[model samples]
Target: MTEYATGLVYPNGIAADEVNKVLFVADFTGLHILDLVTGKQSWLSDGGGTYLNGIDGLYYYKGTLIGIQDSGNQGDRVVRFYCLLFNVDR
Candidate 1:
């Protein structure tokens, strides 16, 4: 297990796959998947070349992981958001 210091923030959303015994954690940088049995963590997606930051909601459904990303202030642009679907395998 890993620990973080106070004021160090990340991982905004989470989802659990009971059938596969896995945990999904959404961070501002990427999507993190954790194996409950092995305690190993990996990235499902890194948002490379995509607007996939500020992830606020997470859900797992039928081999797909859905993420809700809120686009925070990027210059004077209006704040927007979008949902992303990722195919995740157990």
Candidate 2:
């Protein structure tokens, strides 16, 4: 498969957090959060696993991110992580 963000991970799996306004990219390098509003990138996990080959899929449930990690050794696996949204009243 073709992969972008060469230095990072995943290169495939991607997710969207509507409420938080962030897009989660599971690109093998790690879990990345792209700010939907500003189009900024942030890392969640530097290296989720040894082989962060790809991100099969991603979804949001109860304000958390549930996704799949595709690797070389293990075909595919499901993983869960938390996403926090900070609210500031100006």
Candidate 2 on 1-90: residue-level lDDT in tens?
A: 523233554366766665656666776545666665665566665344544346677787766777777656377778666555522121
lDDT of 1 by residue, 1-90 (tens): 553212214878777764766777777666666766666666654345545556778877665666666657243222222223322354
Model 2, backbone clash pairs (residues 3+ apart or across chains), number: 10
lDDT of each: 0.58, 0.59
Tell me each candidate's TM-score: 0.61, 0.61
- Weakest 10 consecutive residues of candidate 1 by summed lDDT: 75-84
